[model samples]
Structure formats: structure tokens, C-alpha cells
Target chain A: MLNLLFSLLFLLSLFCAVLTGKETETGRALLDGAGAALRFCLDITGSLCLWSALSELLAQTGLSGRLSSALRPLLRRLFPRSAREDGICEALSENLSANLLGLGNAATPAGVRAAKGMAALGEGGREELALLVVLNTASLQILPGTIAAVRASAGAASPFDIMPAVWLSSAVSVGAGLTAAFLLKKLWRCYR
Target chain B: MALLSLTPLLLLGFSCLYALALGVDAYGALLTGAKKGLTLALELLPALVILFAAVWCLRASGLSELLCRLAEPLFRFFGVPEETGLLMLIRPLSGSGALAAAGELMETYGPDSLIGRTASVMIGSSETTFYVISVYYSAAGVRRTGWAIPAALCADLACFLSAAWISRLLWA
Candidate 1:
């Protein structure tokens, strides 16, 4: 899917540049494109390092276990079987909790660990994996600090003034996502 | 806004206090895990490059504008501005790209303008759906992504469609 998008973009850019007589501009854009991406990655490295370190501390201190127990009822419902597995449940709980706090950068490592743990369950777990992906991709973000900051920087008198709108739209998305995932999983099972 | 800026510090302090109370070698664990996390980011760098390059070219070459032109009527029905139509598509694919695009719109339309407000709200509401899928599934070494793409994209659409309405109801 990504392959298709990338190739199409490259081709379209070339065609557009030629049509508009802006061939030189396209070359500049290409280098600028890579440069922008590199800078973006580097910018994230600082937070990524901090969160990774924190996650490591989380495991070493067994806070993840405490966290799992704390959120046991909800985690169990989301991941019934895996919630019984201490190691996996720890990662899953951390991922979901971090995400809810709008700490997606912090959520990545734990999300990866949780995904890896679910994959270890072997066959017949594809549905669970799909559900996990959907939830992670569109999970409600209660804080959304980054967006608020952007709004503030852009000079909004009240950056978080849109929190109610964010909450409403996010809940609607998650609801739609969960329903689609459930229906898709059922249909997939019958087909298989 | 002040609280939002302090989140990272808050989380950091809480974790440190928690680690100290637990008598853990927090510093050692941090270095170990940070190194591992850096490596993961390094490995994913190529994918990020590909995604950003494509998005950049799409914007610079004006194809995004063309695509927006084609999709305008549909998005307009949802009350999104013509200039921000590209954001509805890009927001679900790349976070940084979406951020850059939103910044551009906010710059052009003023942050409090309808276009800027819609973009701002959209950022908080939607996720980088494809990016999340690729990262998680690849880390898990899962070959089959199943119905995740469709389901997540459905959520993205919901966010996009509601962004304009939500922004108006709140800010208008």
C-alpha cells in the first residue's frame, strides 16, 4: 500500500514539474524532503530516549505489574487472555495508559512490546492483533498536550479551549473503530 | 497550555520518584532501554524518510493541490476549507507531515480562523493510522495485517468528517 503511494507521488511530481517547467524546483524539493524527514526524526530522538529510559525503569521497578493490577478490570476486558499473562499484560497496560494520557511517543516502546507479545501467541490471534492495532491507531487522547501547545504557539488565547470538541470527535472515532473491528473480525472468521 | 507544556516533566518526575521508592537502579535501566529505543528509531528511519519524501514531493509538486481539487466537493460537504482538504488525507498517515501542513494552514489562515481551528482540532482527534499499523505489526513480526487498515481508516474518516463541525461548535 505504501509502495503504491510513494511511487505514485514520485511519478506525479516528475510529471507536474515537467508540465510547469519547474524541473529545478523538483530537485530542490527532493533534497529538502529528505532533509525535513531527517530533522523530524532527530527532533523526536530526545523524547524517545527519555521515554525509553523511563520505560526501562518501569520494568526494572516492577511498576508495570502494579499498573496492570491497577487497571486490571479494564485491561482484562480489552485483552482477556493476555491479561492473565503477567509479562504481556504489563506492556499492554502501559501502552494503553500512556496513549490515553496523550503520550504517544512514550507509548511506542510499550506498544511494540505488547504487539510482539501478542504475536507470540501464534495462530488464531490475528483478530486480537487487528483489534489492538485499531485501538492504538485511534485511541482517545485526553490530554493532547502537543496539539494544545501548537495552538498556543499559534497565538490562541486559550489553547485547550477545544478540548470538548476533541473529546467528542475522538470518542466518536473510537466507537466507530471498535464496531468496525468487531464486525470485520467476525466476517474474517466466517470466511476462513 | 502551561499544563500541557509540563507533561513530559511531570511524567519524568513521577517515574523517577517511583523508581527511587522502589529502590531500582533507575539510571542504569534508563541507559539500557534508551539505547534499545534509539536503535528501534534508527531502524525505522528509512521508512520515515520514504514517507516524508513522498509527502514533500506531493506538496511541492502541487499534486496535493490537484488531489485536493478533485476531492474538494466531498470534503466541502463536511465544512472543511478548500486549502485544508489535504490535511484530512495526510493527518491519518504522518504526524510530522500533518503538523507541518497544519502549521502552514495556521500561518496562512490565522490560528483562530475556521481553517486553522479545524486543522488544530483534527490533529488532536486523529491518529497516524498507517504509521501505527506498520510500526506495531513490524515490531511483532506479523505478516498479515488483517482488517486493521480498513478499521483504522474508518476511524480516520470519522475524525475528518467531524473536525469541521466540532471546531465550529466549540470555537465559532
Candidate 2:
């Protein structure tokens, strides 16, 4: 019922916006927005395509496998259970690589794949998957390359200007999100 | 004329190099991903357009002015400028809008200027509230969003306070 109300309000606002302006003004704004959106879309698509291709090549060359092996120690610490499991380490490496490069579009699928690999070790249930979701959400981003790229494309004086703040905020947010997720999971378990 | 002539060549070279390095077969991957991106963009477009239009109309209709008047005292309590309240309201809906406003403030004042620093700090440190709410809650199938809204607003307030303090400490 509340969802219906929100949807109604949203639709009404959209309708009113469309009806408010003269045809010319509305057309112009739409065109401008479309152009900006297209540019943004293209940038992210290009990043994803390039990263996907690179990841494929890395897999074929066995470099990704080696990289996974190398990072296993650290990966074990991060995801203790999943580290010993097959394919988990490789997926984690791929996800981490994409994330570090700031290719979120590319990273998402790899993260999902990693989670699936992790979940194979556990029974299929909501309780088991909750931790996976939290970890994915808490995926540590050293740099928000996508947002930085967007800001650069938007003509910011210094694209790297937000780097410090991004690093700080992401660190805090990831820490807080993980802590909350853990506490909630524990509390839920206790009640159950 | 020279720069203009070189621009296309530079772009073409970059594209060719990128394609070669990535072993792009048909450019179809690019096209497919771009199509997805366009769809995502279009999905968000109506909401964004409606949001901006509503805000603009509200200001034109004097509702924002009245709200601004009402918010003056509250703004003072936070050591934020009266205009900052308008910005706070807008920031949740549109990141670009907030950034533009912040840019204007930075330019009018100096980059290291108090107001400029504050605005930049605010812009950098905060998330678009409505966007976060819509994405996270909708994905989780959360309908109430009552507690969520308050929690988010409280976080925003904390961010604002932290931003102010950090800006003063770092830049001032």
C-alpha cells in the first residue's frame, strides 16, 4: 500500500514535469540530459569491455590463477572459509583486480561469481547468503575510479581532488557496514 | 586549426590501440554494454527530471522561499549558511546539481575560502540520499523506509558536522 502511494507520487511528479514546460524547453532539456547520459554510458561500457577482455586473456595465460595463488594468504584472512575452497580464490582475485582498477561494472559479475563459489561450501539458505551480501557490499574500494572519471568528464579542475575524501569515506563506510552486518547476524542468530 | 586536426587522429589512435590491446572482435561487446548503460540511464532519467522540475517549480511557486525562511534558525544552529539548507535539500536528489552549486560557491569565494572549503567538503563526503534510499530499499523490498529515512538523515547530519570540522582542520 505504501509502495503504491510512493509509486503514484513518483508518477504524478513525472507527469507534472512533462506537462509543465513548453514543448521546445522540454525537448531541449531532454536532449541535453540524453547527451550527458550517453557519454556516461559510453565511458562505463568502454571500461567494462576492456576489463572483461583483459580478465579473459589473463585467465587464458594462467596469470589469474598464479595471482590467485599468490594472494591466497591474504584472501584466507579476509574470507577464511572460502580461501581453502576451489575457484573461490580465483574469483576473489578477479573481483579484487577489477575493483582496484575502479571498474565497478566489471567487478560486480566477478563478485557474484566469487560469492557463488563461496556459497558452494555452505548449504543454500538465506542465513548463509547474508554474509556474502554483506562482504560484497563492503567490497573495499581504494579509489572510486568511476566517480572520478565522471567528475573528470564533467570538467572538474582536478579529477583526483576527491581521492583523499573517497579513501577516507570508503574506509569508514566499509568498516561500519561490516561491523553492523556482523552484529546484526549475531543478534539474529541469538533470537533464532 | 592544428589542434583540431590533431584531435581526431589522437582519438582514432587511442581507439585503435585500445581495441588491439583488448582483442575486441566485433565492437559488439562495446555496443551491448553501451546499450545496457543507455537503458540504465533512461531508467533513472524520468525520476531525475521530475525531481529537478519539482524543485524548480517549488522555488518558482515561493514554497522554497517560505521553507528557507523557516529554516534560517535551524541553519544557524549547525553553523551552516542559510543557503546551505537549500543545498542540503537539493543534494539528496542530484549529485551534479549539488556539485555545481558547490563549484559556484568555491569560485565566488576562494577554493581555500571557508565557505568554499565547507561546500567542497560537504559535496565530497556525502551521498545522494534519495538515490541510496531508492536503490538499497527497493532492492531489499523494504516498503516502510520510515526508520531508514531517519537513519540516513542522521548520517547526513554527522557527515556535515564531520566535513565542517575536517575542512576547518585541514584547509583553515
Candidate 3:
């Protein structure tokens, strides 16, 4: 998928360059793009490191665990079938807590653990597993750290000013995702 | 609104205090986490450079602008600006790609602009649907993904559309 996208963009640019007689500029654009990306990454370094360090500290201190455990009730409601499985409940909590903390690095391992355990239930676990994935995909983090970092680096006067908007959109998206999931499951069951 | 900016600082302070109270070598943990972050940055560099370059090339050739123009009406119907068409299109496929496009959009329109805020909100609210679906399903060995992709895409669309109006309502 990524390969196709890359090739499509480049191919069109090349074709446009040919028609516009700006081949030389097109070549420079690629170099400029690389340079910009390097600088952008550099700008992101501080916040990324800071957030990761903080999340790490939280994880080590068990604060993240507490957060995850706090999610237990909600997870129970969302993944009732899988929640009854051995160790799956704990994994789901950790996954969600890590995700909420914006700890993407930590979230993946725990999420995979939950997914593996859920998948072990065979055909009966499909709906619950799907729910888990949707929850992860549309999971709402308290802080929009990465996006704020990007905005700050881009010279925004107030990078976090979009918090309310982010919160609103995230809630709407999660709601939409959950609704679709439930509706689709029902439809599939009826058809089956 | 004003307090929202303090979230990161608060989280940091709380983490540090909690770690200290727990008798966990807070300094050592910070260093370890920083190392992890450094590693993450290193891993992110190549993808960032490649995606940024590709997006830049597309933008530079004016192809993106033309495409945005073509998609403008559809986007307008959804309350999003035409400039964000590329961002929305690439968002579900790749995080780094979306970041690159968001950076470009903010740079071109200024980060305080409605379009920029909308991009930021959209990026914050949504996830890489296709990537998440693939990773989670493949890891669990689930062959038939069923309705996951459609559901996630619906969420992405909701995020994008609401981001535009929400940004405008809140900031513009």
C-alpha cells in the first residue's frame, strides 16, 4: 500500500515536471523534502523524549497500572467474552492504559498480548477481538502530545489550543466506530 | 482552555512525584525512558525523511494542488477545506505520511489558521486505520477481518469531518 502511494506521487510529479518544463526544480524538491523532514524530526526530538520518559516513569511507578486497572470495568463491558478469559483482562487493561497515556510503544505489546489471548477463543472470540481493535484504533488519549508537538514545532502561538476540538472529534469518532461495529455485527448475524 | 496547556507539565510532575513516592529510582527511570525515546527517534527518522520527501515532491509539482482542487467540492460538502484532502487521504495509511502533510499544511497556512488547527485536531483524534487493522489482525492470526476495516474507516471519517467544524467553532 505504501509502495503504491509513493510511486503514484512520484510518477505524477515527474509527469507534471515534464509538461511544465520544470524538471530541475522537481529534482531539488526531493532534496528539500528530505531536509525538511530531518529538521521536523529534530524539532520533535525533545517532546518525544520527554513524553516517553514521563510515561516510562509512570509505568515503572505503577501509575500506569492503576490507570489500566481503572479501565477494567469499562473493558469488562466492552469485551465481556474475552474478559472472562485467563489473563486477557489484565492485558486489555494494560493496553488501554498505555494507550491513554500516549505510550504507543508500551501499548502495542500489551495490545498484542490481549489480541493473542482473545484469538485463542476461536470463532467465538471474533466479535470481542474486533471490538478490542476498534477501541485501540479510536482510543482517546488525554493529551494530544504528538500533534501538539508538531504544532509547536511549526510555530503555533498556542499549540494546545485545539484540545477541545480534539476531544470533541475523538469522542465523535469513537462513538461512530463503536456504533458501526455493533451495527455491522448485528447485520452479519442476521445474514448468517 | 488555559489549563489545557498545563497537561503535559502536570503529567510530568505527577509521574516524577509518584515515582519518588514509590521509591523507584526516578532518575534512572527517566534516563532509561529517554534512551527508549532516542531509539524511537532513530527508528522514526527514515520513515519521516522518506514520507516528507514524497509529500514535498507531490506538493512542489503542483499535482497536490490540482488534486485538492478536484476534491474541493466533496470536502466542502463535509465541511473540510480542500487543502486537507491530501492529509485525510494519507492519514489512514501512514502516521508519518499524515504528519508530513500536516506539517506542510501548517507551514503553508500558518499553524494558527483554521486549516492548521483542523489538521492538528484531525491528526490528534484519528489513528492509522489500515495499519492498525493489519497489525492487530495479523498478530492475532485473524484471517477474516470482517467489519473492522469499515468500522475503523467510519471513525476516521467522523474524526476528519468533525475536526474541521470543531476547529472552526472553537478557534475561528
Measured by TM-score, the strongest candidate is: 3
> What class would a CAPRI assessor give candidate 2's docking?
incorrect
List the candidate 3 regions with Cα displacement exceeding 4 Å.
Answer: none
Tell me how candidate 2 scores on lDDT: 0.50
Q: What lDDT, from 0 to 1, does candidate 1 have?
A: 0.74
| Descending-DockQ candidate ranking | 3, 1, 2
Clashing pairs in 3: none
Candidate 2's displacement at residue B57, Å, is 2.5
In candidate 1, the second chain superimposes onto the true chain B with a TM-score of 0.61
Q: What is the C-alpha lDDT profile of model 1 across A87-140, one tens digit per residue?
A: 888888888777766656568898788888888887645567778889888867
| Candidate 2, position B147, lDDT | 33
- The per-model DockQ list reads 0.48, 0.10, 0.73
- lDDT of every predicted structure (CA atoms): 0.74, 0.50, 0.83
Model 2 regions more than 4 Å off: A1-71, A123-128, B1-44, B65-172
